[model samples]
Target: MSAQPAETASGFATEGFDPATATIVAVTYNRSHLLAGLLESIVRMDPKPGHVVVIDNASSDDTTQVVESFRDRLGAELVYRRLQENTGGSGGFSEGMRVAYELGSTWMWLMDDDVEVLPDGLARMGAWAPRFKSIQGRRYDYDGSEFYWQYRVSVPLGIPIPFAPAGFDDAGYRPMNSGCFEGMFIHRDVVRRIGLPDPRFFIYWDDTIYGWLASRVTRSAIVNEFVLKRTREIRQWDMGTRHLNASSNMYRYHIMRNRGIMAHYYRAHGAYRPVYFAIGTAATFVKEIIRLVFVERTVRGTSNLWRGLRDGARIRRDPSFRVMPPLEEAPS
Candidate 1:
């Protein structure tokens, strides 16, 4: 795609900021059906990405064949890697970003296999490239309603700013202290400064911490433009202002277990609030319990909550837990 000149004085130079310099990095595990839809959406992107990197997490399905079916279909270069074991979303994204960076991509668009990019999604996000180093476009749920939680992130509480106005500024963007990897369009410099998403998380909160770290070094924000459409359908509880989706037992466990990882990041960044985090953690457990009993209509996996909390408390001392360097220090 041809580059457009920056329209504002505060905007950086737009040279080399087009989609041709961007790489779409996606991770999938046994979701060939969903992956095929995402790949098909890429085939329809207005200005295609420079490269497409798909990290297969050892799926015992037709994922390889599905990706192969699109080999010659995509105008952009396609690179596929199938790991021997399932390393989950964190590992897949880490490896995908590493490959994209080594490929010399100026921008890396990170997402899962479940969402399809809008035809103009890449183009719309690119329009803001000259102004923000880290950017996230809007997303639509399966029913075509806007995903409301992508607006603002409260770095101190380590969650989306609750009850914050969902509207964007007059500039059509809202400043964000956190990021969602689902459709995050980030510059290479941010990656270099913050390093890849910590794989130890293996599932949840990795994106939150990664986005928070990116915010420390750049103008991170979520633009008021829809760029992705989620294809997966899940039961959601509408709370008037926000919606809480039902989650799986595995995700519930990670949501609790990963608090230690979040605490580590917060402490590393000097933003850890023991009292506040503890309160928040307690509140989260209560909400999950309610979701299980009422929304999910079962209490089968309640034990995971306690087990995860116990593991989370002890995880800080685990020798394998990674401690990221300060943002000022360049990534090793």
Candidate 2:
């Protein structure tokens, strides 16, 4: 449960980074069963989190009851909030992080309710906290196979390029340009400086942007240590870039819409070279067409693809976007 504190060089200071200073902020929808398993795992984590907050996105299920059951069993302070409306993953995390920050947590570990953390995962992450502002844990499927989470994006084109399957030495880390929220541990300083994630994303691309923002401000890396295990098998649409082909209409709509919105955001902010903008847009179009024919192989999917692209082109950031208040003060 303990290791010698890592010495700090520049970025995050390891001296003040304590396991007890980290708060686990998990967001869930109607998956009470999965949420229960996740909570159980958190309690068993070595050097457990300082506190835990569960953000329920207006689940019609017994999500509230499940969290209540753990209130007494968990080793840390547990707070459960059920929103009046479903704000999707984007909003749920935004609210959860806000609460964690307000509660004075030094680090917020963001995740969904489907994955279980290894007993020593948090401890492992803590060892590297002094060197990086953001640390992502390695993830594996329930079957014990490592998830291909090392995917990177092209510098200017923004296309996904999966890293080659490889091994890492103990305590080794790799610089990351993108990451998922499943096992992302971040310092409160990054949240305070960069601001909360844009809630308007509703679902997709929000985490990627947040990860980029964190990396921009301070050092970030993916810890090669397997600190978490995914309980479910990887789904078909889980493939990078080919995700649109295997997704439902709703998911497809969001993915396409967010892609365009993010593209414009990056361009306007000069995140990438302007010369490659046309190349990136063209590459995306070609990729979708190929996916529709080979992977999706349905006329209906084609229609949805076109519609998503058409509607997505008009997508813009919500000017009224603001971080939601803490659960206690949230409007009815």
The segments of candidate 1 whose C-alpha lies over 4 angstroms from its true place after superposition are 1-16, 318-320, 325-332
lDDT of 1 by residue, 194-227 (tens): 8888888899888888888888889898888898
Root mean square deviation (Cα) for candidate 2: 6.2
Candidate 2: clashing residue pairs, number: 0
lDDT of 2: 0.74
Q: Each prediction's TM-score against the native?
A: 0.92, 0.83
In terms of lDDT, model 1 sits at 0.85
Q: List candidate 2 segments past 4 Å from native.
A: 1-16, 163-166, 169-171, 237-246, 272-275, 281-299, 316-332
RMSD per model, one decimal: 3.8, 6.2
Cα lDDT listed for each candidate: 0.85, 0.74
Q: Evaluate residue 309 in candidate 2 and report its C-alpha lDDT on the 0 to 100 scale.
A: 69
